[model samples]
Target: MLPRIHSKGNYQKQAQGNATARGNTARSHSSVRTTDSSKFSKLKEVLVNNLLKDYHRKNKKAGNDAIYLKAVEEVEKILTHGRLTDKQLKDLQRKFSAMDGIPEAAAVSDHAEQDSYPRRTEVDEVNSYRPQPPPTASTQTSPSKRRKQIDEWSVMTLYNDVKHYEEQKKMKEKVKNEQQRTREELAAQIEERKKQKAAVKEQERRVADEQRKKYEEWQQEMKLIENEKLQKLLEERKREAIELKRAQDRKKMQIEEDKKMRARATMEKRAQYEAVLKENEKVLERKRQQKQEERELDERLFRVQMEMAERQARTALAAENERARREQDRQLRLKAAERMGQEMENKAAEVERNIEERVQKAQDEQYRRDMERERNDRLRHDRIVKENNAFLQRQIQMQEEEKMRRKEEERLLAEEMKREAEAFKREQQRNKVLRHQQCMQQKAMLDKQRMMKDYYNENESAMTEIELRLNAPLLKQVVQEKPDLPGELASKINLN
Candidate 1:
């Protein structure tokens, strides 16, 4: 049927292809046993319909898994070899119709050709443990031959049962582990992204803070420079005022000296004028005009001095106000910067917390999903195994009953055999007890080995996870250093 399945596709392809122009040659499929076009066409239709039926399960959706893909490949191989018989094709069709995937028969047939699913090999291994049928009474010739045989490796029989249970556990655990690893990887990736984002934000914040600090320092330096300029201007203004004061004093002194000299000259002139009273009246009038000019000059000097003192006082007050205003502005800037720092810290911490919560949620969801999947697999496997065991038990019981029936009639005539049988039964009981003990010991050892294997596997996975995390930081650093590089290139650097 495998070849026929492929031949069906081939025939259709040929019919639609250039081969259709030729009549007899196109109708004949040399690689397959079924040369009849109509029967072969029916075979293909039946195979496709059966496969579709199997794939269209509970949800009425059709899809392929590993088993389906392997079956297709098997069909292709059968066609390629041109060795498929009619019997194999019919058997293959029956299997596809009866099973959702390959059956034990198909697996056995393909074992010599391909090893697709190895677990099916265990079906034979498990069957090997069935106790051999007891020998007939006719074969019992002597009492010495009746002693129970105890093989050294008889423990293996009991171990086989444990092995099967462990195999089932391993299968379920394998799928669960794969899902767990995927979840962990996803979570790690998310965490890594969060870390990178935070780190970048922090770096940017630091850069901005540094720029702000530098800017503030520059402002302070500029403020100090302005204050110095104001101070210099105030001192220069004071110096100008004092120079004006001195100049005014010097002018006043000069006026006083001139008056004194004029008065002295007038006194000398008055002594001379006593001789001539009429000539002296003109000198006295000139003296009065000089005194009026000196008085006016003194009043102007006093007014100038008072204005200079007021101007100096106003300049000092303005400089003091500017210093106070600058100090207040500095304080405001420092408070704002401190507030901004606190806000940034709070925001970063909040983002970190939210990310952690999200990660924990996802991890829980993944763990739940893995547990559910593992449970389903174990349940399904156990059910199938139970059915198979029940069927085998029925067959064995029927065989035992048939053998017992056949020996019933001969039991009365075989007196010597009855005694031998009694002895053999006693020995068999002893052997059974011994075998049970050995099997228990073997089970213990196997369980221990399984535990160790599981422990190591877990450790290996943990180490792998740790390695991934360790590499993430290096990768991030690489990306930061060469930001202009393509992302692929940057990641590859750390990967290497």
Candidate 2:
């Protein structure tokens, strides 16, 4: 009986150990499943974060429709493949909002708007029809009796909400991006036009400079030619003036020689007249009446000679007057040539002055044009830079607004998920209590059946004992009791 009791205790302990092992195995499997789910969740979070960062980083031209659409597609793929819950979606939205720096006020208003969606009504309806466990008598549930349940419709609704939010965001971003691109294109076109205008102006300026340079070169050549001609004219005038002076000196010398010759002839004529008178006087002393006629003739001849001399002197004087008139005319011509040369010199000087003025004026005009061009270019560049800065500011503002909107959506989602989770927890608690009650009732029934079976077994054993005593003598007469066998034979018989 002791060995039998000990063996029975051993069997009970073995059964209990097996039950504990099975529970531990179940717990281990559940832990492994939870660990895998946590890993997947972390991976999903990391993927979504990277995607959000990529999208946000592409704020400039990289934020064009193609990249935006690609990012959207990737997000959709993640959503479809990952099958994240509302909580997970909310977390991702929150991450996006955080990265983009969303405002809380906007989130509140968006949440209010979100509550009015038709899907929320569907979710509420589903919530109202939550499955209740059958009635039970217990107020507590056993830990072992607990089980997990999921609501597919609620998950689907949350997925739809996430998708709807993403779609709206995508649409807004697309429109904004297009407007930004258009503005940028317009600015670019304006810049290009300005550049073209500047290039054309520069070309014109270069051409003008070349023309000016050529004109200046031509002016120098003309100046050189004019100066050469003036120099030649002056040299020619100087040579002619020298020749005129030499000719005038020779003419004066010839006039003086003519005067001297005229004086000598007059003296010779007077001397001859005196000699004729003296001879006539001597002849008169010899023959008074005869010499009278001769003296009268001589006197008449002297008078005739005097008249010729007077005529000759008058002729010489007229010739001298003629020469003097010719000298006066030559003097007037020389004065006129000198005056003309002076006037030409004055005209050449005036021309050089005028040319200098024109060149100076052109240089000043070019300087003014260059300065004006530089000023215009500076103004244009400054304006472009200012516009670009304004554009960037506007883009940043829009991004902030978008972030606020996302944050609002995330907050609403989180609230809804929290409410659903609380409700689910309550339901789980109620179900667990019901299961515990059922398990208790089944265990009580099994205990009652086992007690009844033990009672019957004890009674049968007592009756068998009494019958064995009553049949002891007859059993010995009818059949001899089997003798005990050796260990080896007993073992072989038992095996057989």
Candidate 3:
């Protein structure tokens, strides 16, 4: 019976041991489930907080706050899930630490409600439940330490990022202001260049104006010179014409003088020819008078010779007749001789008377011829004497008249010479009067001066002597004498 009681005790001990093993397994499984749920919830809370902070930081960098809020909503959706991978947990942890402080739970809840619908699930239980454990000094210290570390990392990263972004913004603003100032400076430089170009153009215009004025002045001077030259040339031509006219006048005067000389010569030659012709005519008249005288004398001589011949013949005839008558008477005379002798004596006496008468007639005729010839000679001599006497009288009259005219001329010349001498004497007398007047004036002046000088010396004798000599005249006497010649002889020596 003891053996059987021992076996039953062994079986009861085996069953108790199996029950304890099973209980331990179930407790371990429950613990694992709780831990997993707790871990997932923690990771979701980290993701949500980290996402919100990341969005704020990104928005600040991008300058777009609205897009940052949208990113936070997506994080809330992941936080509502009950499970998460290891990579997701690590990313959530890094992002959350970058946030300077934990985000508000109310803010996450309000955003989650606006974006998601409500639901009932096992994941919800894990999110809503809180775990409790017995407090220890070491455990409390560890959790506080971990939270402080995360907070410090977040504050450091946020400060550095915000500071860097502000620095970049200030640099960009400075660069933009500098670009605007440079543009203003370039515009001012362009305006200055335009002003310089205008000034240069004005200077060139002034120079051109000066040159035009100088050119006009030069043209005026040249015109004046040309006018002067033309005037000079005209004057020279006028002088030449005047000289030519003078030369022609001189030649004409010389020709007239030569013609006058030739005319005078011709007149003289004609006067000489006429004088010679008159002298020849007078000689021919004297020869004709002499020939007539000779012819008259020849006629008288021939008449005398014929008268002598006739008387001789007559005497001869008378003698012969007487003889014949005597012979006859002789024959008869014997008877009467005694009676006729007385008659013969008377006849001889009668013949003697007749001869006497004839001789007287011849003598009378010769006396008449001698008387006519003598009368003619006397008449010719008287005529010659009368012509000579008249010629002499005319010559004497001409000489007397010429002598009278010469004497008259001499008398006129003497009167003129006397007048000229009188005029010369008057001129000499005038000159003498002037000289005397001047001398008197000089003497008066000298006397006055001398009187003054003498008065100053208290003496008047020098002036008194000079006055007495000026008033006195010089004289000379002539003695009379008797005439040495007789009155008649002295009268014949009358003064010339």
Candidate 4:
């Protein structure tokens, strides 16, 4: 049972090895599979000879014969069994070691191992992970004592290449960063624009709301105004109607009063006309009675006048006869008296002639004395009248002068008193004016203070009013007394 298990495990290992070998062979000969077997072998030989010569040149001291034998053995094993086991690989390595000057053959085996199992290096792994660096000048320069200069140049070139690469990388990074920033900025700006548009829409809505509110307010105010106007118009119309009613009432009252007055006047006129008619009838009756009495009186007067005229005529005739007789008698008596007077006058003339002589002498003496006495009396009376007249004239002149002096003194005194009164009045007026000015200034100050202050009292106003009233009375009194000069002067005269 152990042998069977061992054998089975060995068989599986062999089968896996055969499959790996066949896959390698088929992959190696895949290019030449389309050619004839002879040509394929010849191409394979040429490739192997070229590979060996390259290996020999890299290791000059390597024995070519030993390397060729080892290569032929490897070819035979691949041709016969199509594979080489680990033991067979070890045997071929020993064969290469047994040969002299076959260092190239070992190197070939090492190269084969390297090809099968590649080793990872830091440079290779770094190259794979990172990017490739540009070629530097050092790689192209010949090896010499001036190699350091080449190295420096290579280092500078390498630095420049690295710097350029870094710059390009930075530039790419910068470009990418800028693109990202630009995209972000665009997005942010779009968001901000959306916010601004929303804000503007809100503002517009608010404005529209405010406008609507204002319009509503305006409409309400207009309605109120219209109502007020309508009320005012209605009130005015009512007032007009009331006035029209009042006017009509007044007109009716006036017409009624006029009718009453006219009726009263007509009644009074009719009464007056009836009274006038009665008075006219009475006057006519009285006139008729007077006419009758006048006619009777006229007839009586005419009879009396005729009888008296006849009696007068008869008396005149008797008187004429008596007058004739009396005239004759008077003539006779006058003639007798004349004769007697002539006789007496003749006798008296004789006696009177004697007495006339003495009487004439006496009369002449008396007339002379009388004439002298009359002239003396006339002279005395004239002297007395002149003396009285002169005395009275002197007294009158003295009185007149005294009266004139008294009148002048009174006039001067009155004028002085008037001037003094006027002066006193002026002084009072000036003092009053000053007082008024002070009062006005005080009032103004008080008013200013009151204006500056927050409150006022009634006392100040009452005091101001009292002061004004007092001043008004005083001024009125002064003005009223100013025109009393003529009346005052007239009152001073003594008529007696």
**Full ranking by TM-score:** 4, 2, 1, 3
Name the TM-score of candidate 4: 0.27
lDDT of 1 by residue, 315-423 (tens): 5455445545655676666555556545655654575565556556755765675577557657755775675577557656755875575466346436645775687
User: Over 4 Å off in model 2, which ranges?
Assistant: 1-195, 198-202, 275-496
What is the overall TM-score of model 1 with all chains considered together?
A: 0.21
Flag clash pairs in model 1.
1-89
Q: Which candidate number has the best TM-score?
A: 4
Between the candidate structures 1 and 3, which one is better when assessed by lDDT? 1
Structural similarity to truth (TM-score) of each candidate: 0.21, 0.23, 0.19, 0.27
Higher-TM-score candidate of 1 and 4:
4
Backbone clashes for every candidate come to 1, 1, 0, 1
On residues 252-296, what C-alpha lDDT tens digit does candidate 3 reach at each position?
575466456545644554454445445545644664464456445
After superposing candidate 4, which stretches have Cα over 4 Å from the reference?
Answer: 1-172, 262-281, 299-496
Error of 2 at 67 (Å): 27
Which digits, one per residue and each the tens of the lDDT, describe model 4 over residues 1-496? Answer: 0001111124346445544655544444322222221332454455434434545444543334335545654653344334446676556555454545557667678668767986643222212222224325654363222212223433444454456557766986786677456545544654575577578667756765785677578658867976896698679768867976896688668758766775676577557656765775676577557556655665565556556555655555565556567766777666555565456546544654555565566557656766775576567557756765785576567658866876786688679758966986797588679757866875685566556333323221221232234234433444455655455323322110
Which pairs clash (backbone N, Cα, C closer than 3 Å) in model 4?
A: 63-101
Model 2, 1-496: lDDT tens digits are 0001111124346445544654544432321121222343234335544555544544421222223323344454454333456676566555443444335565456556656764424344323223334423441244234332347755665465456657756976786577456545544654575577578667756765785677578658867976896698679668867876786577568657755765565466446545544654554355454345545665565556556555655554564455456556777666555565466556655755665575567557656766775576577657756765785576567658756865786687679758866886797588678657755765675566456556644442231332334334433433433445456534433333
Between candidates 1 and 3, which one is better according to TM-score? Answer: 1
